[model samples]
Target: MVQPVSTLNHPTLLESPQEWDLSTLYQGFDDPQLTGDLEQLQQTAIQFRDTFRDNIKDLTAEQIADCLKQLEAIAQQSGILYAFPALIFSADTRNTEAKQMQDKVLEALTSIENQLLFFDLELKNLDDARYAELEQSAVLQSYRHYFYNLSKFRPYKLSEAVEQTRNQDSLTGRQAFINLRSVHLGEQEYEPVSTPDGKSCSTEAELGALLFHPNAEVRYNAYGSVRSVMQQHNSLYGYILNSVAQDHKLENQMRGYDSTLHKQLLADEVSEPVFRAIMSGTRDRFDLWQRYYTLKGQALGQTIRTCDVYAPWDSQPVEPLPYKAGVETLLAAIADFDVNYARRAEEFFLKNWVDAKVRPGKRGGAFCWYIHGKHSCLLLSYTEDYNSLFTLAHEMGHGLHFAWISDRQSYFNSNPPMILAEIASTFNELLLLDYLLKQAGDNPALKKTLITRQLEDQLNLLFRQSTISRLELAMHDRATQGTFDHTFVNDQWMSLYHELCGDAVEVLPDHQYDWARIGHIYFKPYYCYQYTASNIVSLACYQKYLQVGKDFIPGYLELLSAGGSMDQVTALKQYVDVDLEDPATISAALKYVEGLLDQLQATL
Candidate 1:
């Protein structure tokens, strides 16, 4: 067995890059506690169903309060059980033990989740008067968002048999195609970097990093290798995409949802108009993306390709920052915002809450995962670039949000939705960017570099993400209309490219397969819009922070603490001034991106 990444000795957790300590989650897959917890969870679920499934609608307010407690207890246990193995597997997919443990967890979870499915459906079926009566009780006030959101599906509830069958098919159905895509993309290695000791082929993320490489030849070779590999498998990837898209379409149709995007908006607790407004607002700012790309090409003193868009301006060799230095940088910046936010962030490192090392088999990209009513875990592959530091801040931002709010809210409402979740992470990124800019001071050279990168983040977080969402909308719409195959998918994907970048940058032929490259469409359709939504709102939040300084911290903290206890739009209205429903909110966000572009241009 691959030994667990050795736990750290120094408090820094970075003298050597630390892997997360999962002992708190479980001792091992074979730890009898794994089985014991599963059994206990299963028992609780069965007991819950047996006691409440038939009588949920009739439970008095006090009884309903108790019912929620039992359900929350059951859910909290199951959440931990599901998260551990799933996380372990991502760290090392090659581990047979990890794989088998994850499968076991999935099997147990499916069974438990199946048993508990009756709770929500039956709860939703309660008469309006009953649900209102339960919600109005002072005892139930804390859970108001939980039950109200639960009852949201009253209009769309399917028969128990249909829902159960759908859950059963989930593993083998669209999920299988998603898994296939994951394995296929993860396994393919690209040509090595020109640096000494570089291997003959690189991991997918290593290839992605090359897009930022200063050596133009190395970047182009890596870019070509990526393109060639993607093209080689593009057809099969296309097949997988079509299969999953078809599966999603079939599910949406069966459920009577208005559209595919509509389904996701509902889950995010956002309305369709809000989603489209963010999307359209971003679309109207494609010129900002074009300006950034054109300016980047000028800085590079060469024609810009899709690959070169992320290339940093200065060609000087950037010495990799020590991981500890990166942490200090982020912590100091966060401290400038709010001491508690910084303190909460420091705990991730001091307590060994992060797995920030890069190794073969660990997942690509960075993510923050929640541990029910406890703290959180952050996983990332840290390089020494400013981008790496930004990623560190980005995830710790999430860790801090989850870490703090775990105490503020109950199990039922503690887990925030995507709409609000992105705000914390993206907001932290803004904090980091602001910190970097201030540190640059009057040094134009440093200022130019940091500003360019900051703008690049906006392009990435705001514009590129929304473009992907637009492509998703078209692809899903076509799927609903009739036949959709790989070719039609490719054409639509490329069409969005032409529209998004115009004549500013080359789209290249193989970029058509980008839809397949995105795992989100497979896992959570139309989810990309949230990044745009969150980034724009985050810009608004940052602007407010600038205006009110420390006064803004309380509201921002309140925003995070509210978690998923309220629908996202309502949460924003209650805590912050931004409104997702207003096109003007998005318009203001675009102006922020435009301002960044203008700064970059002024530097040029």
Candidate 2:
């Protein structure tokens, strides 16, 4: 459902280069500096291991702080070394040199990590009393959360030798399967479909854009073509998926995790009870999802099929918003909210940190990759529509979040957990929504489009993502027991799809192959639920901002600046007065969705 809106035909916009400049990291794969950095990173790792391999338990608080600072420097070096080739590979998956460099970097980094694994392992092995004393010392005050988070994994720590073995094996074990999925998808050729503009799509991203086309036949054919490719290769994708799941299953057991979900929640710094609450809360509100789609069906004067979910509400062709116009509008929205945020966001454009050009061999979807102690880079294929505009705002929100973290926190504390990662991005989207709605003014058609778009986003984020999470749980359960084939996954996906859609939307046959297309399931397990949880939290935070007005900016900024220095639950409660543990918090967000549905219904 996340696709570009329309193709930009403006000469001025088209003339501007939309690629990101990576000279800030390195000039090229063959750059001499890239090799120098790798050599230095390996040396640093050796020095770190030789200095602190078995001495962590005996070190004083000040000595521990010094050790951490050294590790932080090493991490920054390794980040640059890995990020360079990885970014190049992302820009063009088919680039053989880039892919080779990526693999080489990964092998080297894995060895480096293996050398440095003893520091955390020994730290986690420290006695509880001594650990508490060092954690509370003034010398280690800045790293108190770092120590606390490390200790949470104490029960999951394996022997240093075993840990090192796993790190080395992942090159050909778990990580290899993940890479296979990426390369396979990148090489896939979807059958081209006809569009109203006589446009044809060769890549999955281009085909995805057609799903939002005004013509129903175009949407249907695009959907069918995408699934047909997945169906043709379902066996390979299924094997990759099973391999990843089996790896997770074995590792979970080895780490003493009660369930695969437990291990994922631990990494997110979220409690199992809180995760269950979010899932239950989302599942309880299936009616809202059904009601919205039912109304969409009425508006279209036809039963909403699976492919019609993203169909345009208006049959008239939409004027493409030029890329420059989209940028200006996004900046204006941030400026209207706060001038400081707008100023920081402008740097992404000014510094050439964004790659928005659409081209073959480039990966599908958008992501913002942040290098600690440096800036973030965004990648997206821009087609000059409202969806692309919102995607721009979302990824920039991530860039701004990382900007604050890089400015305020150490590298050790800069990476926020996945659960909190989506907060700023989703918050930015809501702000843009409000700005565009107000700008619509007396234009009822524009207002309806904006409103319906927001509703669709909420549906995708809340209901659809939660359903994916459910499928993940089921998949992991089967993996824990024995094994499951593509057919098992297909049936489970359809079952969950039917549960979510109920009698409102028609569940198509091609929808069964849809599970193969979700890259996250094969890449990061349990990542989908974070989208659901973050959406709920973002809605609550946005509502609070409306109530508090200007008073809310400082605490919100502080939340972003805090990064991983504090647990997300405490950060949310302290900064925005939103409690994730409370059922009422979930109810409030669902109420807001209902209010939006009511507004759209009134328009109908």
The candidate that achieves the highest TM-score relative to the unseen native structure: 2
TM-score for model 1? 0.94
Q: Residue 50, candidate 2: how far off, in angstroms? A: 1.4
Off by over 4 Å in 1: 1-11, 196-201
> Which residue pairs come into collision in candidate 1?
none
Count of backbone clashes, every candidate in sequence? 0, 0
Best by lDDT: 2
- Tell me the tens digit of each residue's lDDT in model 2 across 1-604: 1122212222333334388888999999889999998998999889888988898888998899999999899889888888888887888888888889999999999999999999999888888899899889999999988988898899999999999999998999999999988887777777888776777786777788787788999989999998998899888888889989999989998999988898888888988888899889999999999999899898899999999998889998567777777877788788778888887888788777888887777888899999986789999888767888889999999999999888899988998988678999999999999888877778788788888889999989989998999999999999989988899999999999999999899999999999998988988889999998898989988999999998999999999999999888999999888898888888888898899999888878
Candidate models: Cα lDDT each: 0.78, 0.87
Candidates' RMSD to native: 4.0, 3.1
- Candidate 1 structure quality by residue, lDDT tens digits, 82-139: 8888788777666667767766777778888888888788878778987778778898
Q: How high is each candidate's TM-score?
A: 0.94, 0.97
